[model samples]
Target: MDFFHGQDSLSILEWTLRAAVTFIFVIFTVKIMGQRAISQLRLLDFVIALMLGNIIAHPLSDQRIGLKGSVVATIVIIVLYLIGVFLSLKWPRLRKAINSTPFPLIKEGEILYKGLKRARLSIDDLLAELRKEKIEDVKKVALALWESDGEISFFLDPQFEAITPSFYQLQTEPFDLPQTIIREGRIDLSVLRKIGKEEEWLTHTLRSLHHTEVNNILLATIDSQNNMKVFLYV
Candidate 1:
């Protein structure tokens, strides 16, 4: 007799139901935990999230680990989490150790090579991020930081004058979206009616931008100046 011979036979229906339940629980739990997703996650936060995922996935995939196992794992994680939270509160040094500090990437218009190396970032990557921030020139950057949460922040040189382009050149300003009036492809129909534009106008505008369907847009906004901005997922 084999120890593995008695493994539970999983049907497609069982798997599907388990997957759905796992997904819903994860989504709901994350919502309750607040919105520190991915790019905004600290190391400890990421680790906790990873453990939660594992806890949620185990009973869903493994027949041996039933709902009881999932509940036990969740309780253990919650207790550990509470302990961590209490410790972080009681000891500031422990909190600091858990949450690493942000590293400075640039200082006084020069790359802090030591910090950059520690951050595993190259000068070219710094330049690319600077350019993404609509800074056409690197000399304008006074300071930059690779934040602990993995977000990049930059400070500009106040004394350094912006480079002046020659006459007759049409310099394009960087694109920025306004405050969201509509979200998740849904028009705030109240605002639309108040602004004297119907759904037809929205459809037309999106069509102009090569978006034929409203579902294609991830976010849509209209500024106080009445300029509309639309964003789509790739």
Candidate 2:
């Protein structure tokens, strides 16, 4: 079946060329707009991207590009951008009057409820970002700023620590797990050598506990207190 229905249809080659041109145009247009397309996007940047995407899409699918349609749209977007930039520079008071600044959500380990209210952020929203950094208690957070781009910047206390799990109270630090020296009745000789210990030291330690063979041990660890914890099968 002929899809074009006798209309002057574009050959595959023509379609490929048109698609390539459109792709390049869109990429170049986006590049000209700066890195705001990905990072630190404000309300105006978002609106322009949406409108530009729509304008670019319409021409690709539509059968006709009228004499003045695309040119008019491009000119309008450029004009608006230039006007915004010009006005922002020429009149600082006007710019500040229009675009609001970032509000402080927290300061010195205290939540600014009034600022949160003004920023339209709930306690839950604030807590969620805190939780992302595995911070259960907000008391350890020194300062948290709500950026103008709607991102939360966290400044944690240097001495902040997470609450340890019940079974792992000795594990005060996250990456402080002790290396196993003995497991399932076998001596981890490699571990012993890595820690600068020898078979004689292991044997002497075992002799003190009335055991000579590693096979009798079920679990052994160098605890955080710098003590060897040996659990033997009874």
Candidate 3:
């Protein structure tokens, strides 16, 4: 059975086998590449993505192209990509070259037209980005940087910033993440136990405070204070 190096005319079963093996190979390759490879597409990452797509796609579409050759080429490319990533981490110059340093788009509430040109962003693009950040006035921005990941980081001027608890040195309780006890009209016994509460306790609390059955509640959560909140299905 010709599986990897397909014949001139491939059988449907052979084609299916090739596709399945390719799919599994792609999945494992993606797994090998950590989260950053998926999330952030830097220069190196972009090159790797393009190369892999082109290499894998040709063999799958054309029976004349051997599947085994594509797989071998992909393996070599992946190895080279890993080496580039490792070298980028060790060398600052290479790192900067691969993922360029942040360019200052705005300073002291003034837009840098040269920065915009260098970043290859038009005035309309800048305006659209500002609108997305909900800043009506450019003067309100103290600094705005064009990051390597094609995202802009904005900093509001001190006068335009909101007053926070830290500004007044106010005391605040530690933030507590509420644990889910019930979801989709089903009670989670493990979560209930983790919160140090019994199933009977949950039943009794729901019946007394909310006057609702466990099955009727769509979602429920409890905080550190044992304060249970319930949401019923609409």
Q: Rate the local accuracy (lDDT) of all candidates.
A: 0.67, 0.66, 0.79
What pairs collide in candidate 1?
A: none
Tens digit of per-residue lDDT, candidate 2, span 15-40: 44443444445535654543323346
Where does candidate 2 stray beyond 4 Å?
1-39, 64-67, 158-234
Assess candidate 3 and give its TM-score to the true structure.
Answer: 0.77
C-alpha root-mean-square deviation, each candidate:
11.8, 13.3, 8.3
TM-score of each prediction: 0.54, 0.46, 0.77
Per model, state how many residue pairs clash.
Answer: 0, 0, 0
Name model 1 segments beyond 4 Å from true: 1-39, 160-234
Best-performing candidate as measured by TM-score: 3
The true-versus-predicted C-alpha distance at residue 221 of model 1, in Å, is 8.5
| Residues 189-222 of candidate 1: C-alpha lDDT, one tens digit per residue | 8778667788887788778865557887788888
Q: Which 10 consecutive positions of candidate 3 have the poorest summed lDDT?
A: 30-39
TM-score of 2: 0.46
- Candidate 1: C-alpha RMSD to true structure equals 11.8
Pitting candidate 1 against candidate 2, the one with the higher TM-score is 1
